[model samples]
Target: MRSLRRTASTLALLGLLAIAGCGSGSGSDASTAAGGAEGVPAVLNFSAPLVGGGEFSGAAMAGRPVAFWFWAPT
Candidate 1:
């Protein structure tokens, strides 16, 4: 009886570990960026040519959530 209980407990633990291991890693990697764990860079400065006829500055977008997108052809 004791052996059965121990085996059941071990199986439950292994099951939990397996599920955890398969969980999403994106959240962790996103937070730990090049700047630091918070992933935000201080005094961030970026300028890019606008499609119409202007430039964009990262400083102007400070304090707002920003996302960068890229496309690559295979």
Candidate 2:
């Protein structure tokens, strides 16, 4: 049907746009840093306070993928 074809085309175009938006930008490569270990990103050089006590340092997890789950009071 014409309606089905139009819907499919719109979905395809949106998918392509989403993929393009996720692509890396023309910036410095994150896999290499001047003062960091080889293959480690400068983004790993961060420190954040833990909920209980102490601190969390991203440097402790260098060369590994990091995921954050942040919850703030509304």
Candidate 3:
């Protein structure tokens, strides 16, 4: 009976997790005031240091289409 209870609790927890993991997919908060997403900033007030030298500016990349590449070690 205890094993059956544990199995039921595990199933219940999995169902809860699955439901919670689902997103609404509306894409509202993820956008800026100009409705731009993914590295498209509505305002120009950010910058970052380059890997080699100098610094990159966000103002330079605003209102333009660019390709972004990401690398990760798994």
TM-score of each: 0.36, 0.46, 0.33
**TM value for model 2:** 0.46
Against the reference, the lDDT scores of all candidates come to 0.61, 0.76, 0.64
lDDT of 3 at 67: 51
Query: On residues 35-63, what C-alpha lDDT tens digit does candidate 1 reach at each position?
Result: 43243444345567766769876556555
Candidate 3 or 2, higher TM-score = 2
Error of 3 at 25 (Å): 6.0
Report the candidate with higher TM-score, 1 versus 2.
2
Residues forming the 10-long window of minimal summed lDDT in candidate 2:
24-33
Going through the candidates in the order shown, the clash numbers are 0, 0, 0
Evaluated against the true structure, the overall lDDT of model 2 is: 0.76
Q: State residue 14's C-alpha deviation in candidate 3, in Å.
A: 0.3
Question: Best by TM-score, which number?
Answer: 2
- Give the CA lDDT, 0 to 100, for residue 22 in model 2: 93
